[model samples]
Target: MGIDTFKEKCGYEIDEMWLPRVTAITSILNKPNLYRYFADSPNYPAAQRRLDSAAEWGTLTHEVVERMLKGEIVKPDAKIIPSIKAFQKWRENNIMRISDPEKDVERLVVDTKHMFAGTLDVVAEVNGTRGVIDLKTSTGIWEEHYLQTAAYLSAYNKTARLKEKCTTRWILRIDQYEECLGCKAKRRGKEGVLRVTGGKRICNHQWSEKKGVVEFKELEGYKEDIKAFLAAKELWEWYNKKFIRRIPNYAKN
Candidate 1:
């Protein structure tokens, strides 16, 4: 997308200067799994529609999760209650303490040095260690998540006080799925399609009730991850050079 589109879709402008969004930059990376998904789908339009629907669902979950983090009383949409319940269960079992939900939730971070920006989900102290906590509603955590969170952690720490600097990052994935009783297979009905994995194919599977699942993983080697993110940013810049060059406020370097 062009600069105008970034302003509308991503809102990454700082002081009238357009900077590429972290997610937009990361989108430049080749995703083999996504390619396989498209290859396995019926057609391009059908695959894209599923992806779009998944994005909408993710957005809803993000909004609701942010509200819950802020301690706001929320009546979650019926579509996402299972996921929300899973998140709540995780919250109850963990020691993640958001010091100030108002400032910590959905906080926007900018990397002036790198000329990119993104909104981080949460900055909190988990089990006495402070870090960035990114929320996801995907079926599984992928390698690209490391690059995205590394970018957020670097950008956030650049301007944060020493006490507030995040030393690590975590991906908090909340999802709801069913399990096949006979075959021990997991089935997900998100993304506008049903996907089954890890079970005997020929078995007449008795599916379990829909339940939430939460996975929390701490990312390591962020120093290298940030380097990778910058490289991705450079490649993204090259891809959008024509549009980027027209934006007067964007840093030229």
Candidate 2:
């Protein structure tokens, strides 16, 4: 969505007053790659070319599985052909089972009065209990990543009458990468562990495959983050109304 549209929906003043922080905050929630895949139309030809180049796409999946089982960080690479292939496989296996094929299904009604509206990726029964599933592409799983999934759960909870026993939500992580010859040398050195050294810890996290994708469990920090965002949204709405009142009516002249 455009800045103006987002501003109006979230009830925030979009001028120089609150633009920078709002933009940054939104950027965190709206990752560029995620938006491109979900919000934009797929570039079929380009996607096909990448898939063609990764002849050993299955190898990458095996590597991701091995790394998770061994608790090792899968190094990041510019080429993400394997990750795309993995997601394609995941969609073929799980989308229909977890997602309501009927777009008209009454999932939830987000109150856009003080918040922005968004759609849940999957809103169907998971093991006889209703839950949500959000997909992600990453080199490896991490604890902080769970926050995004939790945010989705909070958003869904706000507007939908979720099943009483259905408190479970999940982040489906697909690690897309090609095996590099250099990894052998790096793994032999201390720098290998230092390479994926951001966030709170230096270890690679693992996720268990629930359906077709690696399921990331939600954390308490994510719940607090969502609460803070909703509170800020309310304050932003109030500021916008107050600012509009201060604008002088020059049309009478």
Candidate 3:
């Protein structure tokens, strides 16, 4: 489903251009849960709390980093200090210059060609290359994330109305690292030593400010995936109409 927003001051609504978000179509929640190797011992309440923490950490980290990229120094909150520190450490080692960011490319102008819309996180030059950059805080870079980036790249290229085509798009991960107690027997000992892992980290969540740890990757197969994303959108539309969200007046106008 797509989210609808109206600007009170503008007086005119931008609704006809409404389309499902590139993110919703490529939603991580829709993916098949890959079974964790050593996570069969599930703590339901603890798991829920950790999930909540991850989501919170991700949002706070995004706010802090966005300000930092604009050359603003923000005092990190206790919750997201590790994540901000991790990104800062990476920037120190890497070359980055923010040209522009927080771009919204979801316009109705292309709804006829592409039936999707999305907001971009950033557009900047990193290590000499300039392209759209998306901040991700998920467990690991999933396939859906790749497609989501590709979709945003397509939308940005069109919305910006640039002469030269924008070729590259990136997904920058700003996630916290935590100690994993799952694989204690083999690596650590019978005494159970904790391993620093990205996804399985449970208690005392800390971001490792290791070089290249919190990093960016070119969105590979971006062009090819746009075709896949369009197909998925068509299917999503068909499903929604056939089962739910079929009311005409209540639907997006």
Candidate 4:
């Protein structure tokens, strides 16, 4: 997870692409706080806990989806069962075929040209259109997601040579209402449900849109997006001193 590991695996030291994590760059740049559902609450700790819980659930969702896509049996907990089922239903309904569900599916890639590294979620084709797709449990897709995807695509293109390189890109978002924090937040306002249990507020929530899949083609100007993402990478490096050379005293004359 550190630069040393990257160096050992990538067979290189920190050059142009030291270890500038792609997600970190997009997050540091102008990424919006999509988890601002409880910003207005006086109980900041509870709000933070809520955010933490959602993040943990998101990770679980990713695991479930990954297992299912790889043709592995999944036995998710009771809480995340609904979201898992929803994703299963979507994949079944959409007739998704596992394009490349290999162990290297989610790979940590270093784009030496661009000076960034990140693990891409999925590289596969859905419904016969080949592309790089990222799974999301978030409420909605954001510009930052595209920026992140652009970085992944850049790395994929540079490292791996495929018979037919993926020119199509997509953000496949699968989520259920009960697992969504924002949806639960709305229940307190719209439904006036103040029901509390086991030191937690339980409200009647329902899914608005169970599943959403967006196809982002290279024709959508991914070349331009890559340029912008690299610019942000430079900004992040300069600000964080990632590109600075300290000149170790032992090496220095």
Steric overlap count per candidate: 0, 1, 0, 1
Residue pairs of candidate 3 with colliding backbone atoms: none
As a TM-score, model 3 comes out at: 0.69
Q: Go through the candidates in order and give each one's C-alpha lDDT.
A: 0.87, 0.41, 0.57, 0.61
Candidate 3: tens digits of C-alpha lDDT, residues 100-174: 433322122233346456666776667877677788765467777777777767766775556433678888886
lDDT by residue (118-191, candidate 2, tens digit) is 44455545445556655444434444345434545665667554343236566556642222232221110111
| Highest TM-score scorer | 1
Query: How well does each candidate superpose onto the true structure, as a TM-score?
Result: 0.94, 0.43, 0.69, 0.72
Candidate 4 C-alpha lDDT tens digits along 39-121: 54447776676666667767877887787778889788766665677666666677555555784467666675655678888
Per-model RMSD to reference: 1.6, 13.4, 7.2, 7.2
The segments of candidate 3 whose C-alpha lies over 4 angstroms from its true place after superposition are 1-15, 28-30, 34-48, 101-112, 163-165, 178-212, 242-253
Error of 1 at 23 (Å): 0.8
Give one digit per residue, the lDDT tens place, for model 1 in 101-215. Answer: 9999999998868778899999999988999999999887898999999999988998898889988999999988899989899987777888888899899989999988899
Error of 3 at 198 (Å): 9.5
Comparison by lDDT, 1 against 3, better one: 1
* Top lDDT model: 1
Worst 10 residues of 4 by lDDT: 188-197
Instruction: Show where candidate 1 strays beyond 4 Å.
Output: 1-3, 6-11
- Estimate the TM-score for candidate 1: 0.94
